[model samples]
Target: MTPSVKKIKLGVDVLIENDFDIIENKKILLLTNTTGRTSSGQLTVEEIQRSKKCEIIGLLTPEHGFFTTVPAGQSVNDDIIFGLKTYSLYGNSRKPDSKLLKSCDAVVVDIQDIGIRSYTYISTIFKTMQSCAENGIPVIILDRPNPLGGEIIDGNIVETGKDSFVGIAPISYIHGCTIGELAEMFNNERWLNPKNPDKSKCSLTVIKMVNWKRSMTYEETGLQWWPTSPHIPTVNAVRGAACLGIFGELGIINIGIGTTLPFQYVGAPDFKTEIINDDIKMLKLQGIHFNPTKFQPFYGMYNGKLCDGFFLTFTNDKNFAPYTSGILFFSSLIKYYPNMFDRGKLKQNSIDMFNKVTGSDAVLDALINKKSINDLRKICNKGLDNYRKLRQKYLLYD
Candidate 1:
C-alpha cells in the first residue's frame, strides 16, 4: 500500500529551504545514498551542490554504494560518484580515516535506516561518529521517521561488545527511536566508548522533522518509500526484515533474500510449511498469521530455486512486536525441527554470526538446549523494562 501526505518536509528540505544555515560556509562530507532526498524528490547531494550551502567535498556510503553499484555483503571500493570522491565504509575500513576526517570541516549523515539492529547503515554512522569524536570533527544527523514506528521497542541490548558492526549501539533489535533520537542516545549513553577509550562525544546537530510523532509509521509520515537496499524495497518489506532478519542470518532457510520478496518470504527449497504449521501457531502472536506459499528467487542465495515458506500477515499492527515475534517464530521452527539448527550441519560462522547479531548466545543456547519458548522469552525479555526507561531520555517526538 502507498500513502502520501506531501506536506511533511524531510530534514533535507528543512536544511535546504532555510538556505543551508545549519552548516553554511563549511566544507562538509556527506554520508548518503540514492535514498537521501528532499520532500520534493531532489537528491540531497544534488541540492547541496545546487546551493552554495556547504561544499560537499567528498562522499561515503554503507553496504550499498552511492547508487547501489554492488549487491549486499560485497566490499565497496572508493570511487567517484556525481563528480565527488566517495569512500566506502563497507570496504577496507568501516570508519573514515583521519585523512578524510581532516579533509572536511564536518560530516553530514542523511542515510535512511530500517530501525532493525543489523541494518548496518546505523553501524556505519556509529563508526563514523566514533572517528569524528576522536578527530574533533562535528557530525550532523538528518532525522527520518523509523519505518517500523517508535513505540515498539523489542530485542535485547547488544552484549558489551559483541558483533558491534551490526549491533553497534546498545539498543534493542526494534529500537523505537528516530535516527536523530538514536544518535542522541548513542552519544549520551557512552556507546561511543569502546573505540575512543575516553568516550569522547562528537559535536552533534540533529535537524528534527517538523511534524513527526513517535507513533507514526513510515506510511503515516506521508513519504514515498525509497529502497534502502536491494532487499528492503518497500515499507511492508521493512516489517518483514524486522520479523525475520536476525533469524535469516542463520543462512539456512531462504528468507526470500534473492527473491522479489526479500525478507518477506520464509521458505527453503524442497521444504514445506506443513512440516511445522502447529509450531508457528504456538508463537501466540495474535493477529500475526503465516500463510504457506512458494516462490523462485531472481538472484542471491536461493537464485532460481523454488522455496517453501509462509508470508507474514498482520491483522493488528498496534499489538505487534517485531523482535519478540521474530524470536517466537524462530523458537517454533526449532521446536518441531530441531535438526534445522544443528551446528554440525550448519556453518560455524553462521552460528557465530547469529550470536553476534543476537548480541548474545541466548537464542542459539536456548535452541540447542531445547528450552521452552517461555524460557527463551524470559531470557530475551530480561532487560526490556530497563531499556524502555533508558530510551525515554532521547525521544524527540511524542
Candidate 2:
C-alpha cells in the first residue's frame, strides 16, 4: 500500500517563514534532534544555517544527541557537528547552563513529541525554557503535532512526589497538547520557579502549527514519521509502545534492542499467550488486534530464548488510547499471573511510575484491587476535569 502524502506546515516551517521579520540579525541557538526535519526531509540545522536573518551560533540536543547516534540512557558530551558547537542537554546537564546560553540572543526549540507522559523530550523542553527564562533570554518554541492525536486524554494524574525525567509535572499519560501548548502551561503554572526566586522572570513564545487540528493523527496530517527515538521506529511502534511501556514498570522489557518491533511484542518463556489473549478479548479494546507469535530477542530481557507473545496491530488510529489500553492490559496481566509479574524491578516504585504516567496512584491501586472499569473511569475523570481547566489557559491554537 502506498503511504499518503500530506503536507504539514510544521512549527519550524512557520518559524522559517517569519525568521527575517521576528528574529532578524539575531544569534540563534536551536534545540533539536533528528526528528526536527522539514516537510521535504531537510534538517532544521541546515535550514537555520541557510537562513539570512538568523546566525546559527550553537546546537542543543536532547536525549538521543544531534543525529540520534547515542544509545538510550547514555550521557552525551560536548562535540562539534557540521562545524557548529553542539551542547548535550541530555548529558550531565538537562538544561543549558549560563555558559551555553550566553552566546545567543534567543533560543529556538523544534522537536517532535510522541505525546506520552513518560517521554523525556517534553521535560527537556521544560527545563530549557526555565533556563532561558532565568537568564533573561527569549525562547521560541516551534510547536509540532502530538502524533497520537489530541482529542483523547487518558491515564492517571502524576503526583508531586514522584516527578522524574519521564514525568516532571502533573499531566495525563496521553496529554492532548502540543509542545508549544505545554510550554505555555509550564509558564503559567510557574512550574519552573526556583526557591526564593522572582516568579515573573520567564519570556516565551510558541509558533503554532498551521492547518493542524486537534483530531488529526500523524497519518491524517500528511506528515512523515521520523523515529523520535531508536525504539520508536514507526507510528505503529509509538502506538504500541504507548500501551506496552506500562509493562516496563512491571519489569517486563519487550524484545531486545536489535528487534524491529521492540515494545509491540510482549512475552517471556513463561508467558501464556492464551491467557493474554483471553484477557484482551474480555476487555474488548477498540482499534487494535493482537497476533500470537514466538521469538528470541538478541539482547535485553529474555535474550536468546524463544518466547511466546502477541504483536499489537492498530486497525484505526482515531479510536486508539494507548495509555488507557496499556493500564487495562497491565491490570489483567497482574490479575491473571500475580506471581509471575514482579512490580519491584521498576526503577522508581511501579506504583509511583504508574502514578507519574497516569497522573494519579488511585486508579492503579483501584486496578490492583480489581476495580470495575466504571469505578476506574470515575478516578480517571477527576484528573481529566482538573487537566481540562488547567489546559484551557495555555492552549495556543484553536
Candidate 3:
C-alpha cells in the first residue's frame, strides 16, 4: 500500500488561521506577485482583505509585476490595484524608498523563490530588508519552500566583484534554503546591514510554513508550484532552469527563450547537432539525457531562425548537478563550434552577468581552457561544500 502525502499549510495560511492578530491594526505593505496564495487556492491579498485584520496600505511587485504578465528584463511601471497604491520594485528603485515605508508600520513579504541565486525575488527581499532595516520598519516574511528542496546545495559561491541584480550576495548558485531561512540568514548574518551602525535593524518576523521539510520538493509539499516566472511554467522547467538559465547568456547559443521549452531546449542556428550530440553522449553524464532537435524561437536570440540544438530531460533529478552540467555543455559547444561560438559577444556587462549567474569566471575559464569536466566539478564542489557549511547554520527545517 502506498503512503498518503501529508498536506502542508503555507505560512500565509498559518498566519491567517491563528496569529492574524499580530497583523491586526498595522498599516502593512505586501511585496508579492500572483504566486502569493495559500495552499487552499486563496489569494493572499483577497484573504487579507476578507479577514479585515491588517490595513494593507500598498502592494509592491517584483520583476514580473502583480499579475506576472510582464516580460523578463522589462521594467514595470507603477500602477493602482484594488484601490491600493502599487509600487514596482523592479523599476526605478529596486527597493521601497523611505517615503514609501513612511506610510506603513510594517511590510509583509510573500514571494515564491526558486532555489537558484540568479532569480531576483531574493534580491528584492534583500533590498527590502536593507531598506526596512535603515528605516526602522518591521518585515514579516511569509516563508515558502525552496522549490528544489533544501537538501541539495550546488554551484559556486559568487565572488564579491561580480555582484548584480541576479546575484545579490556570495551564496551558491543554488543555495537550497527556503525564503524564510534565507530571511533569517540575511538578517542574523548582517547580510543586509545598514551603513549606519546606529540605525535599527529590520525586525524580521518569519512566519514559517507548517509540516514542510527541507527534503521535500514543491510537489512533495502538496502545494501548487506556480511558475515563479514566465519561462518557468512547470516543475520540470524549474529543474531545467538550474542548467539552461545559466547557458542563456551565451549569445551564440539559444536556450529556447521564446519557445515552449524555454530552458529545456538549447540550440544555435549554426550548431552541428549530430557531432555535438555524439560528443555529449560520450561523456555519459548521469541523471540527464540530451536529445538532438531543431527549433525557431518567435522572440529572443536567433528569433525566426531555424536552429539545431538538444532537448535536456532530467532522468534522475537528485543526481543532477546543474552548474557543472552547464559548464560541460558550454565546453562541448565551444569545442565543436570554436569559430562559430563568437564568445566575444559576451561584452563586459554580459560577462559580468554570466559570472554572476555561475558565481565565478572559473567555470567559464575552465570550459574555455578545455579542462576536464571532472576537474571543473571538483572546483565547484569545493565551493559548494564551503557554502553548505555556511548555510547549514541557517536552515529552519530538517
Candidate 4:
C-alpha cells in the first residue's frame, strides 16, 4: 500500500505563529469569510477569539457575506454574528469607512482565492489594504494556494480605465499569483499608497504557505475544497466556469440561482448544442472535452424550457489552461454561429461586465469582427509577460 502524503500548512499557520508577536496588546480586525479555515478545518475567527495576546475587535466581510450565504450580485449589510460586529464590505459601499478602521491596530485578512481576476475577493483585499493605509493601520495577510496553480497564465489582460468590482486592475483573467502576492504587486507596481499621497503608507506583511509549489493544484495540496462563491460548487465547476464564463459576454445565461451547475450550462430555448460542441472540437483544447446535452433550468435564463448545450469535462487538469479554454470557447462560438451570435443584441451590462472581467475591449471587438482565436492567444501572451514581470517582486516562495 502507498503511504498518504501529508498536507502542508497554509498562510494562516504562519500568521498564527507570529500573531502573539505582532498583535500583542493590540486590537485586531479580521477580514475573512466562512471559508477561511486552517489545515485542521478550524476557523480563523475561532482561533483569534481564543488567542491570549490578541483582541479581535471586529469582522469585515466581502461579497456573499461572512458565511457565504448570500448569492452573487447581492449586497450585504452590517450585522453582529458570533459575538462580534461584522461589517459588510461588499454592500453598496465596497470600502471600509474610517470609523470601522479606527479601533483596529492591525487587520488580518485570510480569504481563499480561485486564481481568477473577476472573483471579487482579491479586490476586497486591495480595498482593505487601501483603507488600512489611509488610517495608519497595518495589514497581515494569511496567504493560501492559488487553486488553479501558479504557473499557468491565460486570457486577455484587462485594459486600463475599466476597473470594477470584478476586474479590479489590469491583470490577466487567470492571474497566477496568490492574494498576498497580488497585494504586493498592487502596492509596489501599481503605486497604491494607502497612507500618504506623497509616500506609500500601507504597511503589509504576508504569512506564506508551506510546501506549496507553483505547479500544484488544490488536490495536490490535500486541502479540503470549499466553494469560494455560490456558483462554483466543485473543483470541476471552477475549471469549467473558467472556460464557459466567456459566454457570459454573449448574453447566454447559465441556469440562474436555482440550478446546481451555475456557470457550467448555457441555455436558450432556441439554443442548439451541436453548434457549441462542434466549436469546442475545432478549438482543439487539450485536457478537456465537452458533451452536448439538454437541460431545463429551474430558474434564471431560459427557465422552464429545455435548453441545449454541453458540460465541460477535464480529462487532465495538468494540461488545462482555463483562460485559454474560455477564449477559445467564445471565439469558436462567434465563428460558427454568426447568425445567433449577435454582437449588437448583447446587453450593454454584459459587454461592460465581460470587458471588466476580461480587462479589455479587445475580446468583444475580436468576437464582433470575427477575428481568429490566434489574436486572443497573442493578447493573452502579452498580458502573461507583463504579469510575470510584476509578480516576481512579490513572491515569497522558494
lDDT of each: 0.81, 0.76, 0.81, 0.76
Compared with the true structure, model 1 gives a TM-score of: 0.93
* Model 2 worst lDDT run, 10 consecutive residues: 339-348
TM-score of decoy 3: 0.93
Cα RMSD (angstroms) for every candidate in the order listed: 2.2, 2.9, 2.2, 2.5
TM-score, structure 2 vs. true: 0.89
Q: Candidate 4: misplaced stretches above 4 Å?
A: 1-4, 17-19, 194-201, 253-258, 267-270, 315-319
- Of candidate 1, the 10-residue stretch with the lowest lDDT total is 1-10
List pairs with backbone clashes in candidate 2: 6-222, 156-358, 156-359, 156-360, 157-358, 157-359, 157-360, 158-359
TM-score of each: 0.93, 0.89, 0.93, 0.91
What is candidate 3's CA lDDT for residue 29? 95
Q: Which candidate do you rate higher for TM-score, 2 or 4?
A: 4
Tens digit of per-residue lDDT, candidate 2, span 1-398 = 12453456888788777764566789988899889987667888888787767788888999878776677668988889889889889888899998778888999888988888788899999888888878888988888888777776776667667677787778887788899888888887788765626643478888888878786767777778888877887887778877777556546546334466877787778777887788789887877777788878877777787888777778655657677776677667776577434435344566666565555567656765677776755665566678877888877665
lDDT tens readout by residue for model 4, 1-398: 01354457888876676675767788988999988999878898888778767888889999988878788778888989789999899886787888878878889998888888888899998888877777878898888988778876676667667777788877788888889889888777634653357445488888888888787767777788888777776777777667766565556555323467766665556655676676678778787777777778886666677777666666645657787777666667655468544667777887777777777787767667777777877765666777767777777764
Instruction: Give the higher-lDDT candidate: 3 or 4.
Output: 3
Winner of 1 and 2 under TM-score: 1
**Higher-lDDT candidate among 2 and 3?**
3
Rank the candidate models, highest lDDT first: 3, 1, 2, 4
Instruction: Give the candidates in order of TM-score, highest first.
Output: 1, 3, 4, 2
Pull out the clashing pairs in model 1. 267-308
